[model samples]
Target: MATIVKTPAGTWKAVIRKTGWPTNAKTFRTKRDAEDWSRRTEDEMVRGVYIQRSGSERMTLEKALQRYLADVTPTKKPSTRKAETTKAKQLILNLGKYSLAALSAEIIADYRDSRLASTSKHGRPISNNTVRLELALLSHLYTVAIKEWGLGLTFNPVLNIRKPRPGPERDRRLAGDEERRLFAALNDYSNPMLRWIAVIALETVMRSSEITGLRCHQVNLQKRVAFLPDTKNGSPREVPLNETATEAFRDALDNPTRPNDCDLIFFGEPGKDGKRRPYAFTKTWGLLKRKLGMSDFRFHDFRHEGISRYAERGLSAQKLAALSGHKSMQQLKRYTHLRGEDLVRDLDALPKRRPTA
Candidate 1:
């Protein structure tokens, strides 16, 4: 049943009390409006389709994003925590002024279009991948608020909005001459660990962060494997080391002055206070690339090259995923490319068939 009454202030208030549903009340300037809203809300509740949007209406996107950052961002891997937090902050700056309930597909689409036309500090147009990531953050925020945080959002606005198209897949691989030139440049660089890290990345198909964050106990020289206790996917994986990678570990371990505070294998010299940190070599890599006139290459391309080489060596998709710590075959597909000559060799190796009598 619903009760309609006029308050002392001369406004009509309607309150609904049901057997199973929570009591809901609202005030309107006129009795008719209150009565109509009561009837529609009662009917929706009886049909089990009532969503209490009042909470969402009262909450701003900024508050929701703040809560998500406080509650969810900490659970991510350390390698990605900083970057995800930065992206979340950027999103707050972009859409935080709107209320959760006021956000619509049109508003989100406008945000997307504006971001696509935006530029980075380098004056380069923002990449589609970056815009896509921002949208993904908003989408996930809405999902968490609706399902876990009880924000009472009826729908995710981000889901209805169209996302920008993703950029072309990066197929940049190291050519043989380029690889030789790269190593030659690495030898000229001052950092001794740079060459070893490069070699191990190629030999083990590990990422730059994984390599730089490596510790002594994680590696077992005898077992020829490295145990990554924490990875970007929040799962532990064991990476097998080839002969070249094992030798690299041996050389890194031979550093008598290795940091005792942290077991980091690839660590820099101790500071004035005698504290060692992970080797800061990204700048060195950039300088070397520029010096060699190979500015387009990135440290990540080493992992791509390693995985591509394994695929060309006739490693099956299943085996490659296990080696590369990829949980899905689809994720593994990005690195499964074979050169024309590699495919030609496989074609030549086909067995000849004998004629049947």
Candidate 2:
């Protein structure tokens, strides 16, 4: 019930017609190949398991990734979008020639292994978390292609591969005289904004992005609260500001050289688009840290330090979670590392029980 014909170019074509199904056609270089495809397609149609994979077969990974970047990446957070764009370029370099249908689990597994073995430009081994994020992007692309783009993919190859284990949580807190020295160095710096930013981070457990991304209207000095309409977890949070944090915010807001063109609290130099973005101080921060001989201390550790201090002061986990914008106690626990000395002091402050006669 199938027709096979040799075209002028000498390629064989197979055409199948069924009552319940739409017309299906395929071309092959050999008559046998065409006949085999026709038989397989007809059987699959009868069994109600046939899927037209021509679209997926034709679309290369590079083209698909480009489409994903154009259509999907813009919807994500700025940080997430930047990371995915970088990952997409790496994916394109390695396996972009393969079609969606041809990208099997085995191939993806090999890619994962190779990526794990690779080193970053800084000569450090690539972290498992980085590889995992890359795989996540690929997996989501396939899901989108199938459900939304109608690419005819039967499955996501990334789902079948083993993900690398997550990296260990960093518990690096400020030690001994390091805090004193760090503040001294911050005080001496020409840029007073650096000192203010550091003070705010120490007082309030706000992330570096959250601190830098603050708008003029988001802070209420009278109410001593900073409102975050957008956060990493997709939740709005109101961070309570203590006296120290309020002072820092006031300094940044009342900058004499502050431009009227931008409402950003920490406005950067004008970009190519003539728009002032958030202050780009990563390089400066890193250089300052290294100069102060505290290369191991990261900006995020400030949040950890602040949270730990709060925990030591007898703040309940529920209260800490509310202030820190953590959705769960498990997440809050990572940031709250109470000192043993503080615990001992608290224990001594408790009323002692009288010895029984």
Candidate 3:
């Protein structure tokens, strides 16, 4: 129901009443316009369709960008964090003046093209991966504005936009010959500690960080095991030492000035007077790998080689999971890609079927 009444000044006021909606009232240039609004309001109310009004259309894109950056900076890797922070800060300074609502899909597409058109600081064309990352940050800012800050965003216009294609995957593995080459190179090195650490890393499959943070008191020669306190997965477990790895532990203990601190087993990287610090492979391994003619391989792949070797020998999933400290079989499967051979071997062990009639 709607009512129209002329005021003393000869201006007309219109009022509408509808169920499940607030009373709507307004004045228009014509009675027809007021009546049309009343009818639309009644239809919308019946359909339960209404958008929360937005101030985001007036808010600058830069304001939302700053808030988004602060939300995710702490969670990135140390090397990546600094660069992301710088880029986010710079983008805000450059792009912050535009209104969030007015930054349409076409505008974002153009922005992506412009980034690709520009050359980077390193004299390379800006990568699609980087462009995608920057656009992701932009999208995330809009999401937070709507979901977290109660900014009443009626639409996330970036939803239908396509991200640029990423680069090719890097598949790097150390062949058996390369492993032998690395071993021979280690044997030739003067630094006994680095050599032993390299060998242990290959055999035990310990991560670089794990090796650096290993503790003296954690090794038990009697039980032939070492306890890793806190690991990447946030789970602590025991690692049994092989003969070579145990001998390496003995070599680490053989150092003259055994520190009082039980933390950090594999140490010594020059300076600070041989204090127990993180084991460093950057200098030695880089030179060694280059000398051995396998520069494409990474130090982390030693862990992969060790686990793959075990899988080749037919280690069970449960047993392999324990040794590797992997929480899921899916993760274990990634390290053992060729374990399908084990499946074929199991085929021969099936129970003989009864003779068919």
Candidate 4:
């Protein structure tokens, strides 16, 4: 049973008189409306499908975010750790106060609209890729909670919609003057060690991940090769050294350090003074780019450059894939898209047109 009444504010409300599975709905605005809704709710409850009001027992978006961050973040790659942390903060600001159970496809769609209206500290518009990552993080947590933790989720709204198109691929490969400018900027590095670091960055195109993880044992200078235990591809690959790389290693060996230190190539050995710290690629990456006045250059692009440069030089897709450690040539081929010059060169090399007899 339910009672309907007008409030002091002159709005109709309903009060439930019996316990129901959905916690006994309270306000319906009119007696007839209240009765109809209550009957429907009661019927659903009888079928054991009714979802009651969340009220005090509901989990909040913020709580879900914290759980995801604390439990799920540690297992991710170091590069993604910062991104996941940032996503958690953005979710807190966007959907924090909302109840998890109350979320629906419609609500999340509206949140996407709101996310587009948001900007970063740099005043540039947020990209669809950035927003997509945030949604992905949320979606993953929901899945974990429902499947592994058994939260009884009937639907995951995030999956119901497609993410927006990602932003245009920023040009990553350095060409011509940009490469020269990059080296010019590194020229004034008073610390010879930093110079060696920059040179190695250009020569090997090792990611900051691989760079920081480098150990002396990983470098087989005797064989002019370096083996990565795990690259971005989740597979190991050996990087062959050129004379330029060999020279840089020689400089690295001569680079100033404490008398007794560990085998770390970049950072000095941990807990020791003077160049024993492990090489931190990110710290120097920003300065290197700024010095070159290159806004679009990324450390990751160096890898792209290394792969694509000789990729244009007629390296077989299989060989390139082996070097880059890409699981498939499908994705790598896109990066090595042939240029007009390549096409023209191929056409020029075609057999001369024989005179018609």
TM-score: which candidate is best? Answer: 2
Clashing pairs in 3: 214-265
> How many angstroms is residue 156 displaced in model 2 relative to the true structure, after the best TM-score fit?
1.7
Clashes of each: 0, 0, 1, 8
- All predictions: root-mean-square deviation over Cα? 3.8, 2.4, 8.4, 4.6
lDDT of 1 by residue, 193-296 (tens): 99999999999999888888888988999999999987777788999999999999999988776755678999976889988878988888898899888888
Q: All models: lDDT?
A: 0.87, 0.91, 0.73, 0.72
Model 3: weakest 10-residue lDDT segment is 167-176
Model 4, runs deviating above 4 Å: 1-57, 268-277, 281-284, 337-339, 350-357
Judged by whole-model lDDT over C-alpha atoms, candidate 4 comes out at 0.72
lDDT of 4 by residue, 1-357 (tens): 556677777666765554543335456456677778767766676687875443323688898778777888888777677889988898888788877777777888888888888888999888898888888988997788676654556667799877877777544667669877777667766555666766676677566567656777788778998899877766788987778977897677655673444676666435544435566556666877876678667776766777776666777888777766677877776556455676798789889998999
lDDT of 3 by residue, 110-223 (tens): 777888788877788988888888777777667778887766576676775788898543335565587677778888887766777777777787877777777778888778
What would the per-residue lDDT of candidate 2 be over residues 1-357, giving only the tens digit for each residue?
789999999999999999987787888999999999998998998899988888999999999999999999999999989999999999999999999999999999999999999999999999999999999999999999999988778999999989999998778889889999999988898778788888988898999899889999999999999999998888999999999899899989999878987899987889898988988788998998999889989999999999999988888889899899999899998888877888999999999999999
Residue 307 lDDT in candidate 3: 83
* Model 1 residue pairs with clashes: none
Task: Give the range where candidate 2 is weakest over 10 consecutive residues by summed lDDT.
Answer: 189-198
> Model 2, residue 114: what's the lDDT?
98
Task: Give the higher-TM-score candidate: 1 or 3.
Answer: 1
Give all TM-scores, in the order shown. Answer: 0.84, 0.92, 0.61, 0.80
